[model samples]
Target: MLNKLSLLRNKIDLLDIKLLEILSKRLELVKKIGLIKNQYGLPIYVPEREKYIIDLKKKEAKKKGISPNFIEDIFHRVIKESYYYEKIKKFKKIKPDFTEILIISHDKKISYLFKNMLTITGYNIKYIKEKNLNINNINYLFKNIGMLILDISKNFFEKFIKKLFLLPKNCILIDLSPIKEISIKKILKIYKGPVLGLYYFFDYQKNFLFKESIIYCDGRKKKYYYWFLKQIEIWGLKIEYMSVIEHDQYVFFIESLKYFFTLIYSTFLIKKKISFNKVLTLFKPISYLNIFILKNFFLENPQLYINLITDSKNNIENIKKHLDYINNLSFVIDKKKKIKIINIFNKIKNLLIFNK
Candidate 1:
């Protein structure tokens, strides 16, 4: 009876701690929004952006197994309070709100995501339909706009990046559909494509492919491992230096090639349509878990999957090697080979958990 009471007390303590944590997060976000507005000279109350954010909250909540309506009601109250804070400024100095945010994209789904994500934060969001927006007039159009989110569609971006670069604001640019450019021209007497302008190169058209960088856009906006360190002066994050070309090559090799081969292998395994009971006996728990994660990621972004193959060098070699090893697997295979693979798996497991 005493033990049960102690357990209940512990649970209560945990609940209290979690409640404090959530409050802390809310306060921090409030401060961050205020700071960002101060730094960028933007307003605090933006209805359009707020609507977009609330929508995103609803969508994201559904994914995380939360009620969208609950998130919406909570955020609506939060936004109103924030607006009052900005307008009153009785407690402290408040920043002015931005009236315009221009998003360029052809995909309606992504536009909806962006629209909803911004509403909770309260900013004015705008869109210039790709077809209606003039390529040459982008510079003139951006004269008064505060923030610009480019979709990085090559056909669209190639015509106006130079002009957009001239805007005198804290422009945060993210390339959505970046083509990995080749870098051999300087030393090999081959053609090198321009990095930041109209002369951008893609891997599929090249005679000999090389990669320059790997760019990934997970849901949250954060820098990649290699990019953060190398660009400390500019990006001020942790990254190790590798040329964009090499990065793309590695991504193509590891991501593009491996995904294709494994997908094929998985398909074959399923095609035989063997009994689930039999398959479970042969399956490794760790392998099954890894496959589950990979399946989710693959389904999330087709562009990323395709880019991995079309954007790299040396991927084919790696894919073939792994596939050969996979195909050669049999119940009667050498014990030494089995042990080697097992040791490798153990090492990976250890390395992954060591830091955590």
Candidate 2:
């Protein structure tokens, strides 16, 4: 009986050894995945993919009569280890055209964000926070600046544009402030250097790792624009270059108009002493996005909306005209008739600037 017990103990020890070896092999496979993800500049932790993996493991565990919760706990540890390995691994360095970037912004938060992002991607960054940047500092500030990011407020933008001539001719200009088309043309006329107008519509607080960025290209400087595109991509920004006119139009309709309408609706609700929170609780099935908008509407600073609405009057009018045209279209019709009428509109649009 003692001899038989010793042999069984030895067999159990061998099984434990085999399990360790299998786990080691699994880690090796995970390392390979990290390498692949790094090559494509992909994020290490993908929430949807992680959910899929956990669900799959749970299903497999049930087939083997194993506790699903037990399998989930094991996978959680494994996934954590994989993330640690990925974090330890350094990313490949990308050699850009220029080494240093100078960020000039009135917003300290934005300046800090740019500094962090640039530092992560292996670039030397200098951040200058000034409500109204003194022209005297241009001498040292412009020196060795590969790219100059102008995130100035609209109130101080015209003055900032006047000072663009002080920048070194070699330094690529990236303008983020909203300016009139005529004003942009007038400024570019004097500044013979490369300039790229950027209209960042997406909220800076929102994650834009996979989202697209709209950039307004100026002066047809292909190489300069490409360099800017590559620089932004290094920080995981997807850039879309469009005409200045188109950029302004989109901003007016999508950003300015939307904010104005939200403000109007929010104001009306407040005046009526309506409890949006209570209404939101009653309509729990409604989308969280709509709820978020309503909740934050009154909390938003009035100055921002005022700036957008007043500054984008021309583009707002253009959008209004487009909407009026759309409203004039006949809506009540048979399915076949509606299809034919829409086809005619599509055909007309192809010949117009608003079409695809």
Candidate 3:
């Protein structure tokens, strides 16, 4: 029996070697494809092709009596790895239209991420912490800067608004604040140059830029910043143009409200003295997902979430209205108004379904 076990292990080791060789060959092909795509300024992610490959593999797996879900899980990881390798492969260098880009942010992680991403694409990038910004350094740094990215907190940006005159007149200014209303208003008042507001909707830690979404609002001259938009597209981000008021309104619903509910739920759990481990053992998928989101939220700086929730008066007022609605629902439930509650639920369900 021991000898049989040894033989089985050896067979598995041999199969692993073959699998590695196949993966290496596949990655080589992916790199070549990346090169060709870069040459033509094509995007890295093709959703249609990805969907076709996964569906095809799932069909083959079912015929072979393997679990289709198992095959799907494997292929998804493989495709994600393929995308990472494709992006890291040497890109066809495009000469940047701008001279030097300056990134100002209090957050080191965000600043460095931007610096690294732009630097790899052959753009000259400089970074300065918000604390380091002064009249002298601003003059020195803005001398050759054709593009200025403001990635600082909203509060800091407000305080720094008066110093906008230090920047060169021709430099394109881009704001990366999540809440756009205040920043856009303040910036427009101070700076007359080409301005753009960008809100990134992906994890900053992601290694590849494939299919990431960026919602941008036009602030000033579009012609001056057109090349900058093209540069971002070449790096594989999907851009959506929105008005500043519309962007802020959506952000209130999507980000501020979502985080507010998560916080309330977490507080309820804590107040009830619920054991998180016991909850995990219950094996509820939806609960698990909620817990996962809550855990991830706490991993980031709490101040970031606080700033997001309290950034605008509109967000605060909207959240209050939601709470009032919830209170009315609770009163209806207590009064045993089954017919009214049913109507309300149906209306909400239809709204959600119709939007989808």
Candidate 4:
């Protein structure tokens, strides 16, 4: 009986190997289909076709006395993989219109940082000093402008607003102004072009790397979005598309509030007359962790931080509502409920490894 059991186990292992080989062959065919679709300018994911294939697979599985749920799960995973491969292939085929990026800025530090970042990616960048940008000669300024970087001071933005309308209809705008949402809306009214608002604070000398910038577009332009995404990816930067309101709310809660609390904590520490060295010694683990975070994530640009806080202050009512919701949260632990939750998690873990 033991010999028979060993033989059966060996047979099962052989069958598993054969199944994996067949799946590999299937994935090769799927990739070929993805390539063909890309060549024809067709969408990679067709829900109707996917549903039909899955339904046919289910019927075949049922006929073979196999579980439908297992077949469905396997096919869903295959579909997901196909979608991912197809999207990557599509991005590889995109041809951007222009190569030169025109940056209009007076801030030497900020412009220099951007220029260096873009230059590494083989992008030809032209800098037009803010003083040189005049409303009278706006047309001359936009001669070969494919991408325009707007980084003017908030105080001087009013004069530049009207001149932005003269930008060629196809030119992409990257606005780094203080008030982004309002500025983008006004620009979109006249210049029916791609507009992106990028917000971040970074100072390499100070070891402050608030390198994560949130991006929001004025309209739904997939081509420009894809182009910008690829360029930023080359620079090792991260971006996500979100509504202006959602972006502001996220910045308010995540950044401004965190900075405010940090200030409050530091004030109390100073009041207690605790030296930096004493605090570091007292809370070695936490101090080390916070130092790492400050170097990696904290904003060093006071102007940007203040602007974020000011934006948050403008939405005080919404912030208060969220604060009230936070206050309502409880950390009470009930033994029975905790046990039930643990059991549910265990069941989920088991389900993940069910077939295996």
lDDT of 3 by residue, 1-356 (tens): 99999999999999999999999999999988888888876777778899999999999999999999999999999998888777854444455465898899988765567787788877888888887776344567778788899888756776777888878877899988888898888899999989999998887887567779888999999988877777677677888999999999888888888999999998999999999888889958866877778888899789888988998879888999999999998999999999999999899999999999
TM-score of each: 0.43, 0.64, 0.83, 0.53
Against the true structure, candidate 4 reaches a TM-score of 0.53
Candidate that would win on TM-score: 3
Ranking by TM-score: 3, 2, 4, 1
lDDT of 4 by residue, 255-356 (tens): 667665566566786799878677667766856977565444344556655665565445557556656755443231333457656776799899989956
Superposed by TM-score, candidate 1 places the C-alpha of residue 214 at a distance from the truth, in angstroms, of 13
What C-alpha lDDT values do all the predictions have?
0.51, 0.68, 0.84, 0.65
| Error at 172, model 1, angstroms | 4.6
State how far residue 165 of model 1 sits from its true place (Å). 7.1
Inter-residue clash pairs, candidate 4: none
Against the hidden true structure, what lDDT does model 4 obtain? 0.65
lDDT of 2 by residue, 1-356 (tens): 99999999999999999988998888888788777766776655666787899999999999999999999999988876766565423443455446578888877544566566567666778887765457555677777777787776665666667677877766777766664464457557767677777766555664323334556656446576565566565444556766877777767777777777777677887899989778677775757777787666556666656776667549567657756755555442433477768788788888795554
Sort the candidates on lDDT, descending order: 3, 2, 4, 1
Clashes of each: 25, 0, 0, 0
Segments of candidate 3 deviating more than 4 angstroms: 1-20, 59-68, 89-93, 135-137, 266-303, 336-356
Colliding pairs, model 3: none
